[model samples]
Target: MVKELDEKIGALPDHVGWRLWRASRAWQAEFSAAMRAAGHAWFSEARAGLLGHIPRNGTRQSALIERSATSKQAVQQLLDGLEAEGVLERFPDPRDGRGKLVRYTRKGLDALRDGDRIKLEIERDYIDRIGRERFAALMDALRSLDAGPADASEEASVPE
Candidate 1:
């Protein structure tokens, strides 16, 4: 059985990383196409992720790095683009003299709403293709993978 499992693994065309990359790219393409069809040319996966992380109340630019799980430079670049597109604005933090708080403008809020709608459409499409039960199971599996051992040094819990 172990040798059969090894053979199966070896026969796979791509490893986990490659599969994940392909999946992410495919999802991003669908998301981008949906946004374009909705007349939102500027909408992108990065922007959507960033928008999801920012609270309605707003968030500090420095805080976004951790929240977005990205570098400060990358966050700054995204913020600059969003600002240029009139989606968001950065202003000095009231409590912190040097810190900047990023708040969604009216346009930003509208775009965020549109993104949410697009996301729902995409989810529904997936459910339709895979069925509700399969979709739910897929999401649960993904969540479990995400919740794997917190420390990299520790072994992940694999289900039998």
Candidate 2:
């Protein structure tokens, strides 16, 4: 298994996708430690990521599904958990009678504020380890990578 893994990775030393995947895992581990230290023992990274996708005011279920790039069932499951925790509430959309809008409750907003603070602390630690310049460059690179082709007609250019 080790030889096979080495062979696969050695052949794609410049593969950004694989490297990003590894980085994401590492970051999540660090984030979890930070959250634990911050006294949020029940913190769920999945829940946090899903909630981060939601706007403060409210967003339609369909819009959330699109933004989260998650299956309807998966989103619904997360919503149910959050609602049970009093972190979120779902109500009928005022404009669209047929659709539902999901919004954060006061408790949820407070939790979000705390999360933001914790995230900043973690970021500072990361910046200290990586240096401000490298951290800034990493952030810029992440933003660029995140801004993929805006439309179907636009394609990402790949290096040969």
Which digits, one per residue and each the tens of the lDDT, describe model 2 over residues 1-160? 9998997777656688888999898877887677657665656889877987898787898899999999999999999998988889999988989999999898888777777887788789999999999999998888766766556345656331
- Tell me the spans in candidate 2 whose CA falls farther than 4 Å from its real position: 1-14, 36-42, 149-160
Best by TM-score: 2
Assess the local accuracy of residue 132 in candidate 1 as a C-alpha lDDT between 0 and 100: 100
**TM-score: model 2 vs. ground truth:** 0.77
TM-score for each model: 0.76, 0.77
The lDDT per prediction is 0.84, 0.83
- Runs with alpha carbons beyond 4 Å of true place in candidate 1: 1-13, 150-160
Instruction: Please state every model's RMSD to the true fold in angstroms.
Output: 7.3, 5.2
Per-residue lDDT over 1-160 for candidate 1, one digit per residue giving the tens place of the 0 to 100 score: 9998998778666688888789889888898888878877777878878877788778988888897899888888998998998989999998998999999999888876777898789899999999999999988888767767566555555543
Clashes of 1: 0
Worst 10 residues of 2 by lDDT: 151-160
Candidate 2: clashing pairs of residues:
none
